[model samples]
Target: MRFIKRLIIGFVMVIILGICLYCYARLIEPNMLLKKSYSVTVPKDVKELKIVFFTDTHFGKYYPQEKITRLVDFINEQKPDVVIFGGDLIDSYNRDQELVNIEELSKSLKKIKASYGKIAVYGNHDYGGGAEPIYEKVMTDGGFKILRDSELTLSDLNLSIIGYDDYLLGSVDPNRYQLPDAPFRIVVTHEPDVIDNIKANGSLLVLAGHSHGGQVTIPFMKGVLRPGAEKYIKGQYDLKETITGCDATMIVSEGIGMTLKPFRFLNPPNIVVVSLKHK
Candidate 1:
């Protein structure tokens, strides 16, 4: 009887500790910035291109406009040639109150400066009922051009950025957007699952968000509750034939905010800065 009581007490203590740790990680740690750096080899003649990418800013009770300001500040500091947003700019799911002040969010996002341009795509959360149009307006007002299953080329930079709509809420016709031959080709999608559907058309890099790194992951076991994440969740992936037989690298961002429940454990938010250089 004494041993059984001790075991039960130990179990309770572990649960309590887990709750405390989860609260801190979910609330405090998610707000912190994590800068991730990577280098991709491009053509020899192409000059090095710096890219700053972030995504999944739920911009609701979990993520506020203040965080957007901080993110913009950090992005400007990077002095990227191109800035790209993966998506999920808002969160208004069955809530009577507003998630974030749209005007302030727009203003803060506009503060981000890039040499080529600042681009964005829509995410699943952005299409929640009546919030889709509002989110699009915010993105446009903030100077972010939404790329919905389209391609934009920078003649001077000799680079192309391909934007795909949210896999869950929007249609994805990879054949519609052909990857123009360029020194660097980048594809941005809201969810990493799109990688499986689209054949790589000479794209060098693919960037995605929506998984939020499982939002609540444990070590070794992989993200058990990753809704948006299909086969790939977080970090980098080397694909051989996933994209039209051409090899490509796919990067999935952990994202800066939370959804459903404002709780994160083990996984933290991140900002990715990818530098394209000569081999």
Candidate 2:
């Protein structure tokens, strides 16, 4: 009986510790982002441009509109030449039109800025109850170009930015996009698993954000659950020569929202600032 009591006490202590750490990381980490820099080794001669990529802002019961606004403030301060959102921007699911989660986000997210351009795709959570229309509208009103398995070229730099439709939605053919003979090209998607969805010529770099870094990662065990991605489910990873031998840098941001339980343990919301220094 004494042993069982001890075990229960130990478990409660651990939970307390975990919550405390998450709060510290989120509230005090000045920069909640786990920043990464990558060099697009391909296409050799383009001027370097910095990009701030982030994803998965499941702003609902767990995270709110005010929380996302805080994140937007941090990201804009980075002054990225280009900004990209990987996916899962909202999480209301449309079951209730009266929920203020998605609606508030739609109103508050128009404050972000990107010099070259801002682009994004939608995630599974962003498909229901008119989430897409509202999300796309908010982004467009904010001056961002919403890419739906489409590409746009920033004439000033000639870089083509493409957005691949979420694989969970339907089929995506990477071949549809003809990478222009430009200096740089990039692709944004919600889940990193879409690395296989690149049936067409892939971009120089791909950004994603569906795995919340396991949300509540443990000391020696994996997160209680996985949002997406099976292997190397940490925060960031580099997928070199794949089964197809195509080489493009792949980055998976840990993301800035919580899901299921709405409490993050070791995983803090990220606001990544990626500086592209191609050599």
Candidate 3:
């Protein structure tokens, strides 16, 4: 009789715990924001640069547009020289288009100040749900240069930034586009796995987002992998041999928003601050 009683109590306790976890994941955790920082070494002659990178902010029903104010505030506090947005500005342009305020969104984005310039690339979500035109217009209105399968050279900083189209929805033919000759190069993309197809002779730094760190990570297990983010999910990876047998360092952000799932457990929204220093 005692054994049965104890079993019943244990079952009830488990049920209670589950309910608590569900509430936390849904209400408390998703709103939490985190800041992740990384440092990279550049050539001696290259000027040091501070770059703030963020992505995967599915700003729609799940992620409210008002949160952009907080995002811009957090980014400005970092005092970045260059700001790079990885994409997915809105969650679903088709379903949530009417809900978003383009004018206010553009105003908040414009407030984010970057000394050198602001750069952005398309994401899978950006091209999905007829979001291509809206995404481009918003970023451009916010003073961002949208780079699609092209490279932008900052002669003053002697730095080159290569932006690619979304691998899942947009064109990403590395063979068709020529790489810049700048001594320092930074590549930005929505999906990290695209690194496998890019062929560069020298070392490069790649920044990406879209994994959302599984959106709900469990202990001792890997985060849920997305179609385009199978190999590289989150954090930093050093690849000795890429497409052209060149070395590259990649940092994948967890991102600052949610998508299909509205809850965030262990993985919260985040922005990455990269400090590039002279070697």
Task: Give the alpha-carbon lDDT of every model.
Answer: 0.80, 0.67, 0.87
For each candidate in turn, the TM-score is: 0.90, 0.79, 0.95
Query: Model 1, which residues run further than 4 Å from truth?
Result: 1-12, 93-97, 177-183, 201-203, 224-228
> Per-residue alpha-carbon lDDT of model 2 for 1-279, expressed as tens digits?
999999999999999997877776555432354555554554545557788887887766556656666777778888889888877766665643454554455556667778777787777766754576677776666566778788877777656777877767635665754444433467787777766545334336778777777777768877754434655354545555552444566777778776566566677777677666655
Please name the candidate that would achieve the greatest lDDT relative to the true structure.
Answer: 3
| Ranking 1 against 2 by lDDT, winner | 1
* Candidate 3 lDDT tens digits, 1-279: 999999999999999999999999899888887889998988876689899999998998899998998999999999999999999899998989787988888889999999999999999989997788788899999999999988898988888888999989998885734553445589998999887776675668899998887888888766688988888888999876554545579999989888887888888889999999976
Q: If the candidates were sorted by their TM-score against the true structure, best first, what order would they fall in?
A: 3, 1, 2
Worst 10 residues of 3 by lDDT: 174-183
Q: Whose lDDT is higher: candidate 2's or candidate 3's?
A: 3
lDDT of 2 at 133: 63
Alpha-carbon deviation at 250 in model 1, angstroms = 0.5
Task: Give the worst 10-residue stretch by lDDT in candidate 2.
Answer: 28-37
Clashing pairs in 2: 174-200, 175-200
